[model samples]
Target: METILDKIIAKKREDIRNMTELTINDLDLSREKRSFIEKLRHTSEMAIISEFKRASPSKGIINANLNPAEQGALYESYGASAISVLTDVYFKGTFEDLKTVREAVNLPILCKDFMVERKQISHAKAAGADLILLIAAVHGKDALKELHEYAAELGLEVLVEIHDDEELEKAVSIGAELIGINNRNLKTFEVNLGTTEKLGPLVRQSGAFLISESGMKTREDVVRAAKAGANGILVGETFMSADNLKQTFRDFKVPLTVPQR
Candidate 1:
């Protein structure tokens, strides 16, 4: 029986291969030469990178209009640490999202996509991205290492995502200081906060800026994750589903204040 991670990884390898075939004349990253992503100097200050995502493999019709720049502007306005933009075209997203967001927000913009090859590294630079998310399940150990290194050399930050304890090892091995724990199971599309609960300790061991991703729907979940040692939360559905994203971030800042006992 294959896990969700297994299937997504296989799918990414094929998706990336096809995307590379596109010959582009518009993008230009000619003067880019910095390893911003891998540079340990720039630490993830403030909160988790708020993701301006449109849809996912599991959930459909998340947000069609998804104005990436508008969302980024909102997240930045509310004092978010970074903005994550989904760039997988098949997933109803595009690199244009990151480009637009990067232009609007002052914070770092994470290129959240099904990354498998180096083509995306160049895409990040050309599109004005500050960070990139590399899913460990979709990349072999060697490939993950190489990709992280490559992204680092370009002055970009890398957020290595892991679904389980086993994958955490791979993330650390590749020197992934910024880590994202996804709760949604890739194969069955099931979600359980326990995934983050279980992996929290492992990530803490490595001292990475840990973020809990997927299945995050409520402010209570955010507070719970913080208790479990999570530094930030990468959310999409809850925030994206809103009509006013800036208000959503403002709402998130309260973190469900409890009544006095």
Candidate 2:
């Protein structure tokens, strides 16, 4: 039987096959851009990268009917530092979804997907993505380095994602400026926030900006991760599962707020 990752990769290959008309060279490289790294660096409040995730391999459909543009606007209005748009077809998201969010908000948008090929990076930039996620587990160090350089060439920032010490070393060796620690194990799909705690110091020692990804639900979770050295947090399920997304965002950032007179 095929694993969840196997299935997703298969589907991605099929999607690429269907887009034969749009070669890498056909991609529009001149979309006016916002700086994803700059937003993270300049953050004064809780540096939250709120995500527009409709489904997942583990949990299936999540807020399938929520409008991407409207939700993007709401997250921006509530002070999200950046936006993450899942563009995987298996996740029930499309490039159109990402583009819609980009048109809807001025904040930097990360094209969150299982990106493996240069064509995908080109498509991301063409769709108004300000950044792309490069998972260390998926491509390993060599390929990850190559993809990171290719994305930078297209004027797209890369969030080099790692899960453990080995991956963290690879990211550091590559001189990755933005590194993300994913708490969820891709092989088992099990989430453990302690993953960030374990890898946080290594990332800090590498002198890269750190983003803690997955398994963050409450303000306390954010605090714990920050205390461990995460400079930013990429939160998805928490905000997506909230009945009131705006209020949930406010609550998550409460500690970062100053008292009103």
Candidate 3:
């Protein structure tokens, strides 16, 4: 029986077969990529990496009517440090969404997909991605390292994701500068902010910028993650499901008042 991750990989391989229409050399590697790392480094407003996800396997068809370009523009105008464009077809996304978002916003764009091959990195560049996400759980340590290096060679930064301690070690060993501690379990789909807090110390020791991903729904959640040493946060559903996207972002931007002891 194939798991969700397994199904996604099989589909990615199928996508690669169709990618023969364009070769690596055919891609314009020199296209100026905005610096995703630099944007994260310079931000002081909780470093929100807002994601534009039309849908997901877990939650189908979030906002099918949403215009990618318009959403991207709104995210930028509301002070998102960077934008994440979901490019996985399984999740109702396309590379065109990333390209459209890139054209609409000045912020760096992250290609959020289950990357399995070198060609996927090329595809990201072709689609105007400045960064790409690599889940440590799916690729393992060796493959993750290779993909990370490949993305860098193409001038794309990487956001290496880890869901547990073992995966955290792999990311640190690879010298991943941008590390995302996912609060949601891929297998069970259970979410807990404690994942970030528990893994926070190891991440700090590795000297990597910590990005807490998933389940961040309010100003309080942001404060909790920050107290755990997360330098950035990747929020999606909370902001995407909002009727007032700008006001939603404004709410996230407000500083949290930590309770005094």
Using lDDT as the measure, the top candidate is 3
lDDT of 1: 0.72
**What's the TM-score of each model vs. the native?**
0.82, 0.92, 0.92
Q: Give the least accurate 10-residue stretch of model 1, judged by summed lDDT.
A: 252-261
Candidate 2 off by > 4 Å: 1-3, 21-25, 254-261
> Residues 1-261, candidate 2, lDDT per residue (tens digit)?
766677777777777875534455777777777886776566555578999998998998877888999999999999898999999887788999999999999999999999878888888888889999998877777888899998888888999999988888899888899999999887778999999888887788778888889998887888878777787889988888898877788766733221111
- Tens-digit per-residue lDDT, 1-261, candidate 1: 977557666776776776543223444435443343332234433155687878877777788985777777777777676778888754688888777887786777788887777787777767887788888877789999998997776767788999987789999988888888988776687889988888876787787867788776666677677666676778778878867767666655533122111
lDDT of 2 at 108: 91
- How many pairs in model 1 have backbone atoms within 3 A of each other, for residues 3 or more apart or on separate chains, i.e. clashes? 11
RMSD of each: 5.2, 3.6, 3.2
Query: Roughly what TM-score does model 2 have, to 2 decimal places?
Result: 0.92
Instruction: Please list the residue runs of candidate 1 whose C-alpha ends up more than 4 Å from where it truly belongs after superposition.
Output: 1-46, 243-247, 254-261
- Candidate 1 lDDT score at position 88: 77
- Predictions in order: lDDT: 0.72, 0.84, 0.85
